[model samples]
Target: MFGPEGPSLRELAVQALSSVEHGYDLLAPKFDRTPFRTPGAVLDAVAGALAPAGPFGDGLDLCCGTGAGTELLTGLCHRSVTGVDFSAGMLEVARRRVRPAGGPGVAWVRGDARALPFTAAFDLVVSFGAFGHFLPGELPGLFRQVRSVLRPGGRFAFPVFAPPRPARAAFWTLLGFDAAMRVRNALWRPPFVMYYRTFRLGEVLGGLRDAGFGVELYPLPEFGWRADGSPRARLVAARRLTPRPAA
Candidate 1:
């Protein structure tokens, strides 16, 4: 339960127990009201980080959810913007709620991220808050799919925050959440399949390399830095410069 307009505890419980697609279908209407939605500040920061890279052509918001990332794309892409997700309910809410202010026309597609239905069509592809739904074993195929849809020299970008240290309460909280989800999936059918710790940065970079993306990280100064002097958040800017296999 995130707020007065957010899903109730019982509604969230029902969602967690359901299939990932259907769960989001049930939660879609209030998703933006929930903390699960990508925040406006993060969206603005991502748009700012990507500003110089753009005046891009057609764009795709992979797993766009309630369209926060889609809204972000409107400001960056020049021609058209598309939001793709497997959840019809979520897409329905996105269609009704989010509108592009000025840039490209908007389109919504209902499809799984693993098999994106487009070819080398998009100049930029961005995703937010959807990686946790994918298992570690799925990274190569997933990255390949993202790469497949991007044009030559196109970019796939997303922001990643550094994990909280073991000494921090946030670490324990996320660890506990992942543990509980594992137990729940072990006992339930059609697993929800979300894990906070599975998408390690090294592994992700490796997968991107294997998928043929020349990867780079830009510091998101909005989140400042860790005590170790490393960035607290980094924007992953992976570019597809040449042809590649389908993974």
Candidate 2:
């Protein structure tokens, strides 16, 4: 329902009723046309933010939907780039659209993020617009999975926008959407499992810490600041800790 090129209302209804993986499988062809795709502006800002920290060896785009974040990795990583997701349909679309002309070789892997199929293989990892699918309690295990796939001192990065205030319509809109999803899941089989408000910043940071990451937040100046002077958006860069030499 995002545009002429986007999914129709009926299509969206069908998707909403399906399991998460199957829903995206149904939507994958037109997913980029939907507002659900990460915006180019945000991707550009994240690329700019990550440039100095990279020229990385190999990279992974965790939960790499239609490959927006995977495309971002092409310029930053030197060796090779891989996109992993649970949806075969999404991976098919990504394979067609995310070809890099002269940069690192790109590969698409179909696998769940919670059970990634790689070891300490990536020098960098990035994810965008996929966390809402994860429940709050899943963060610790999720972060640990991300950490497990990163080499010593490797970084897992993603951008987070400031949550809208209660006075704002956006806040209520997200709240209502999450509430509706809860009700839908309660009544439906094979729950869709997406919630807008579950990934609180404090909880995320704590989970990253518990996963043994040394975290840093960098303000994304492209989005400006809130009235309270905090950044409107921030990049969360969580680095995997290298093991100390044996005593």
Clash tally, candidates in order: 0, 0
- Candidate 1: which pairs clash? none
Tens-digit lDDT track of model 1 for 1-247: 4889899999999999999999999999899899888888889899999999888999999999989899888889889999999999999999998786677999999999999999999999999999999999998999999999999899999999999999999999999999999999999998999899999999999999899899999999998999999999899999997865799
In model 2, the runs with Cα more than 4 Å from the true position are 245-247
Tens digit of lDDT per residue, candidate 2, span 35-74?
8999999999999999998789999999999999999999
* Model 2 lDDT on a 0 to 1 scale: 0.94
Worst 10 residues of 2 by lDDT: 1-10
How many angstroms is residue 121 displaced in model 1 relative to the true structure, after the best TM-score fit? 0.3
Worst 10 residues of 1 by lDDT: 95-104
Q: After superposition, how far is residue 156 of candidate 1 from its true place, in Å?
A: 0.3
